[model samples]
Target: MISKFCKEVRQEIFFTWIMWGVVILGIVGVSAASGFEHTVTGAYARGSVRWLLGMDLYSEGMHGFLYLPHAAIFYSPFAVMPAWLGEPLWRVLMIGSFAYGIYALAGELEKRYVANLFTVSSLVALPMVLDSARNGQMTLLLTGLMLLATRDLLRKEYGFMTVWLVLGFALKPLIVVMFMLIGGVYARTMLRLAIGLVVMFVLPMLMASPSYVLAQYVGFIGKSSVATDPYELLYSRFCDVFGMLRAWGMPVNGELQTLVRIFVALAVWGVCYCGRRMWGHHLGACLILTFSICYLMLFNPRTEINTYSMLSVVLGIYVGWAIILNKQTIIGGCLIAFAVMIAFSYEVVHQLTPGREYWLPPLLTCVFTGYVLFLMVFDIRPVVKVDRVSPTQSDMLGVDAEKEAEGLVMTSSVS
Candidate 1:
């Protein structure tokens, strides 16, 4: 039986869904009408032309294409179109992808919870949607790909998952971290991912000369290295641990930042190892993915606020699971409250402080995400059902007898 609190949460989620739709439509309409010129999409559009003409794609400053050369091949069709046509088309595509992602993720929830999926998801995603639309960022497309990947993962469709995951990686290399982490648990998926990467790399050579492709790759590496340099003025936009330390007046050079990032990654790897058994369980897998995605966003030196769009689907899943469990622990409540605060803190802080204080929200978000990771690692336990599994079958499946007795057995079924 559903509790009163759960019912209330569902109601709130339903309303949030309606509000999210209204907000998305409003933003899209405004963007289309305003004809924003200086957008990330515009940069990609321009970079596509440069790639075709064999011009220096990375010399155009921050607006230049940071994406791999093959990405230009994909964007060329749209780039060839006039801005009047391409900008609107791009906006429409982004908005459509965002809606599709939300819908797909919502479909993954239980029947009762599904209705609130978009509503609850918007709590974490609305700001990102706004930011992505405003800046013409690729995050909405990335978010959509991630949602598709997660949905396929839940359905045990590893082939589809690999396709979406690799596509996302092609768009942004940071998602490669997710691929590597998940590969540790599912070796077969990793093999498919390697094949997919090879295909993606080869497909671009058909459009550009081999030498041109080589140069593009070299330029990508060089520019990315420069872009992520801690001493660079653009590094101020970083919101990860490295950025937080730098913001607090700590002397963090590129070398030191890279070292700290490596240490943090090792720490995450250790936590994942310790929780390795949990991967076989539904809630446990979701929690691990949540922590991993948060880690990717928080540790990557190039991360910006819009990048949080990638967390939309995972955050929704985490919240839905937490609510379904009806856990009343103080720590759980505090985590939920803290997440909500972080979600809304930007507006309040912006009003109260100057523009330079903009870093506060992302910093607090990083801290909150870290706490959530800790809770998932040490505190959260998977919900298990013993009635369906006999002792013999449990033993055969490698279920820990002691953990099973404590109601911590992994289930084969996702829901």
Candidate 2:
């Protein structure tokens, strides 16, 4: 078994390294051409500089630093470094973390087809990976943490899950959406995470004065309020539901928007709960994070087009599961085009009509979310357990009669 595992890994990894080498080059190329002042890394590192000088962490506009003061402490290492040095390093760090996330996740469930799954997903994830890496965006880091957190949850390793989830929460508080779902499943861990969050929230005070840190925290609260303000004057447009609606010439009322958010949040939690019950841990955990991230992009008030890069890790793996490794070739292929469309969403937006280009990815994501709910509610299992399957795949596989009948009965029962 060890020898066979080695062979399977060897066959796929032999060629995989070459592809990764290309990815590294792409990151280097983007870094070389990008000015330190222009990249998001510049903004990230600047917060630390501002904090060190005892300036306000949050400023007036979208261009102002928007994260918690703790985020500056997180970026301090990069801030101390020169821009040329920091830019490439930060980019590589995020993209590398994302790649490691893929490696870890693919290894967890399907040892035999690990490379096959890794290759397809990585290839699909590359565009967004490259996009985020170029800009030195932290979306990849958060995405990596999400994948690792999902893997830890599957292993019942709540200790490591707490570390990842807490660090992720400190970096971007919006991931509380994920925390809420995971909290629903693992209540005790959520308590540990809550305490962990308190520790992290105050960790910045050790480096700065308490008054200053407290003021920064207050500023963070004010900054967060603007995230849902559709009327706020900003250079960049939000790519959330508000963006989609406003693009269609239907501005939403604030009260209605809040109600909509609550309703959707409940529905998403229900979908995730049903997924866990219907699919069990192996597949359930992956879908939970996958759908949660999708929800984040569509509903989170300040979601930007490039922020959609957060979907790369999960969506890529899901597409590979659907089109390449999945036994259910029928509905699986449905995501293939979407994978491409989403990965290159930053580019696709330019090709679209000017008025509503930002709506494209979120709109497609809504459809994807509905498709997943359909699959789960119908108990339409993908039925491809990589553990027992041969390493070599045939041209195509069909739905076996027994599984098909089971799916029909489950669908009728739900109806």
Candidate 3:
């Protein structure tokens, strides 16, 4: 009966579409039902309007824009549209981008594997996707761009990859760390990336005065520095290693935190560099990309729950690979089940004990990330094995088929 059910699911296209439909409806439903009065995107929209009016981007007691001037220039179009229209349009675009990115990655797998991609991704990404949609956050869009960039990188399309990376960096400058991973593998891509950066920096000058753009950049750096201070009120939002340490009663001094983050990042990068040869295989390459993203999320000092949207992509990839490639079905099923539970950990904990969900969710994510890193380094093996065989005397006797046939005929005649 289980085999019959598996066969039916494999053959059904309607089920696949239904799964995708659920994901789309879920994103739209969550976005429309939630408040967006204080979102990252809204902040950008407000900042764009302020910039046009010659107002200071940063002011006292205001949750002013924290992004680069280029971000304001990008948000100007949405800023002009009324919120009623703009908000829905932005939500739809983010959802579409994320869906397309998942589809593109799924294209790498075989048809049998592709059918379950959306279902698994939706389950694993439920919390983060819903949170991003509800809060009008850029995390989904950033994740999509990063996935697109990874696809391009795997195809050896360095120029296009750089474009994707540049767009992601424009939205969140910390993504620039990805360039180091790319550069180590494809050194020549750095030239294209440099050009992209120059264009990104110069394009804002065309929209706003050079001096104004320069001032905004300076203001962003200064404000960002203050925001990253562990003692600052805003730092409570951080959910990375430093934040967890601080939450656990550790004396997380800013300087020490910076050093620790740098050391961890360097260690992860060294592992990647050492395993650079593994990129020749598809699974190895995916693992490397996923590891780099996981490292970024864990190491970045400013990460929050919204920032974890990127991990959904990693989870989706890992679950998909396990289902399609691993021989242990029970293990794969358990992993998928565990991932779903983790995805909804916050909601479950919140319902049982409100306000106590803070540490557990983030801590669980950190533990899961460590497990993923370990798998990337040690669990993955080459897809194909090299075989060495030497023929025995019996095998050698079989080599002369004509002689053996003659002998068999002579013996039959004697009998």
Candidate 4:
């Protein structure tokens, strides 16, 4: 009864690998053909060279390097190579890890949710993913690491999760939002996080003088602070919630926006504390990651179109799961529509009026966040079949084994 498309998509693992392998080769081939002068690889390469020279990594005169000193260490191997080899290698790392992360996460979801998700979500999110890959953006790498880390967190492997989280810190300071949200749910995570960050901060001293490394760390703080400030950004248009609001004539003050972000952070913390008990770990991880990525797009001052790749991956997977489960058809349809919008946002942005380039991505992210919040606030046990909860999950969720075996939904109310 299965069609050719369904059979191909359902071919477990090798088929997905073949698909992403083609994607990686295609995108990396383009970057290799075109010199990477216009891509963000320059910033990463420059920082690596500066570290080798014992120079300041975050020099004010030479901008575009907002990452921590650890980032230089991470990229130094590629930086030291010839441009021809190094650029393609870096893209390989970005796109390869991204594809692998999706495969790993999709495998886990298929085991749990019983859906054909890998290719569907990847193809749905490909437009944004391709944009990030072509530009050599760290969002690809960070999203990859976070996707792996999300699996570890759901498995209760805090130590492994902390390792991935700290690696993300070396790329962008905004990763702190995810760290904070995860730390809120797993209180013991803060201890592991503190230890991991210490290791990241101290690891660079081995390459350069301790004093030089320490100074770069200090410079990283000042540089990242400025990098996050909207006033420091060169352009007026942003691809965030505020940008959409400004385009819609509902401008909010910067200070007020900070307060709004803070409020959302607190609300996410509450979700972490309470949402786990209401739903199983499967949906809890979904909500945590969804809220984290949505916040980054809707709240961060410097969000770009490429950053939507991170959001797209998470949303795409959830959309596929919703439709496959056949429990929330309406929300699933909305998510599919938005996924189409995001995939076409780049083509559509240029046709709109100036300064409105920031409109669709964040507006779509805001709508996505609303659906995530709805799932968190309302009881979601009905969405998952009762028999799917493993014994350990039932114990952790405090569900009656006999009742769950009888297909009775857990009636736990959200506090």
Candidate 5:
């Protein structure tokens, strides 16, 4: 048994190393090209770190007036470093942390080739690398923390798990919902997380000035209302429900958007609930679907194309699972294609339609939304449950049944 396990580990490690090499090579190739553009917001985030923190140089411009001052505080450390030093180092660190986190998460559940797939898939697109490098956004970091927290929680590493959850919540407060769900399942850990959040978020606010916290938060929300197409504005794709609506000349009045919000929120909660009940092959699918759907439905209507680059991680999880489980039936392939289209529409908006068309993004986003709903309602489940069967009988079910189960296992392993 020990020898067999070691053999499997060696094979998996070989695949992982190959995948990592390919991705790193791709990233280096892209960076070498002169045509590569940095995102304006990313540039701003990097520059603003100095201005907000009064660290290096005096800042200029109206950009600071729009956001919660507190938000900028997070980036001060990165900003203090010169761009020459900061850019490559920051990007490498984020990519490395994300890869490590992915490896750790996959290992916790004993999934094969997670690190390799994550590294390879993330490298397939230009937008994904740009999102991490340009803005120094917390996407990779947040994802890493979430993955780590999930793994730790599963292992009942309550204290350490809570620490990661708190850090995740600090990075993006919305992830608190996910932490809450995990906490609910593990009551003792949840208490530690809740206390930790109060201390973390509160300490920052208290350190800044009591009014600054509410002011920055309120300021961020207010600024967010003046929505820009992340694709058009940032030169990336915009794929979310709002993208379609805005393109179609539909009113984006937040007050009127309540129904959509409520519907999406409920759907997300439902996915989380289902994730809680599943295990083994079903577990990863449940978690990935829950995270992706919730991310798209609840957080992404106002998202920009560059932001959609982050979704590839979730998509990779699904795809990886599909390969191992042999699950993407002809029908499943079509559905996967549709989901990819929706995701890509936002990430690479230029290919789907001409910029003259405003409605394309929103339309694609809505279609993606509907696609998720369809999968949730009808598509993302077992075709048939396996009953008790002799080992010999189960093994002899022929290619069709064996392939189907394999696909299910792949899908179930990550999400």
Candidate 6:
């Protein structure tokens, strides 16, 4: 009887639409309230292009483009096109990449409908597109790349797939490193990663910058270290780390920060170790969430709710949960309700407080920590079942878990 209902739910597309409808409405309401269009647009338009190329990078005293070289490079192509051409073109590119990512993720799960649900729901169901589009941010593109690389990794296509991920690292080193932490350190992955970095990072630098320009690039990286953006949320969150340690009266210095980073890195490593042994995508999802949240917390001192771009990755994890977790216990249901409440409740909180100066750090910390724990524990499972590979998927050079599992476990792949 339960199985029958579960199948019915799985087949129900309207339910997914309804859920997404609510998400869309919420995004619209929030954007209107936040006044994102005018503010975000004005800021980016005023940013200097020369600085972005690592020449006068951060010369005007803003981390605008210095910290994000990968985004800078990709945006360079669109930068050449007229604004009218570039903005819309970039938006379309995001949409296309998102579609590719959905195909990749669904392929990971071996379910066509499941992947379609991810593409449609994730595209329209969140504020990602609106925010990325408004700010001309590459958040969605980065997300799509991360998703695609993860899907490839799961299928054991370590070479080509990891390139997408390595490119993401070159763009925003935080989240990609997180994914690597979760994927664990395998020889094949390491080799692929090295090759990808060479292609994506080293080659790009060599081609884009002359020897003299390369020296300037090194200077820019150095300047970025001392540069602090107070308005950035991640930087503020790093302050929180200091505040937390200081409250305990521990001197929050470079050494402490380094220590905390090491610990977080280890935590990421453990999560990936488990993920490597897992059947679900939760490991990938959790690593992305943990790393993104930590990155935002540590570096983005002025990140506002609008800049919660990485949250979309966590939302992807939730969608994965909806598919994999067949059992919905009251406890689990309550937790899910809490997650939804917190994710959607920020709007309400904003209305009530209207950005008053109060314990924002603790609130963010609690929310991020809870969500990561949820993904690692409830969403990811150790055992996964994979059947015969689809022809299209096989043609894509898919890995057969059954073949990989021949001398290992029961019948399916673990790790």
Better of 3 and 5 by TM-score: 3
The regions of model 5 sitting more than 4 angstroms off are 1-18, 21-37, 40-74, 111-136, 174-177, 180-190, 205-238, 248-252, 274-285, 292-294, 297-299, 327-352, 356-414
TM-score each candidate.
Answer: 0.79, 0.87, 0.80, 0.88, 0.68, 0.66
Using TM-score as the measure, name the better of candidate 2 and candidate 4: 4
Clashes of each: 0, 0, 0, 0, 22, 19
The digit string of per-residue lDDT tens for model 5 on 1-415 reads: 4355457666866677566555554553454352335533354464355446544221233233343343356556656776555555555655666666666765654332223344333333233445444444566666677777767766667788778877766555545556756654445665787788677757656555566556555645555454432333322224455545655555456544556655755666666556555544245333543464345533454455545544545555544445434445563354355345544553355555566233443454355455545655564642233333333434343223454445433233435
Worst 10 residues of 6 by lDDT: 406-415
Alpha-carbon lDDT, every model:
0.63, 0.70, 0.63, 0.75, 0.51, 0.49
Least accurate stretch of 10 residues (summed lDDT) in model 3? 406-415
The digit string of per-residue lDDT tens for model 6 on 215-242 reads 6457557656655422222323233445
**RMSD value for candidate 4:** 4.4
For candidate 2, the C-alpha RMSD (Å) to the true structure equals: 5.3
Tell me the lDDT of model 6 at 270: 65
Best by TM-score: 4
Query: For model 4, how does the per-residue alpha-carbon lDDT over 169-244 read when each residue is reduced to its tens digit?
Result: 8776778888988887767789999989888888878777898888887898787677666555424567888878
TM-score of 1: 0.79
**Residue range 1-415, candidate 2, lDDT tens digits:** 6467567666775576568767767876767775543477666767888988899878775456878887788898889987767677787778777777776776664442333667766776777666667777888888888878877887889889888888888887877888888887556677878788889887888888999899989988887788556456232368887777777777787777778888988987787777767666656566768767888988787887778777766566666666654554665465667767866765667667665677777887788777667777776755444323232331112223444334332111110
- Candidate achieving higher lDDT, 1 or 4: 4
Model 3 over residues 231-270: C-alpha lDDT tens digits? Answer: 5632464667665555566646767777876787777666
Global Cα lDDT for candidate 2: 0.70
Clashing pairs for predicted structure model 4, backbone only: none
In angstroms, how far off is 123's CA in candidate 6?
7.2
Please estimate how well model 3 matches the true structure, expressed as its whole-model Cα lDDT: 0.63
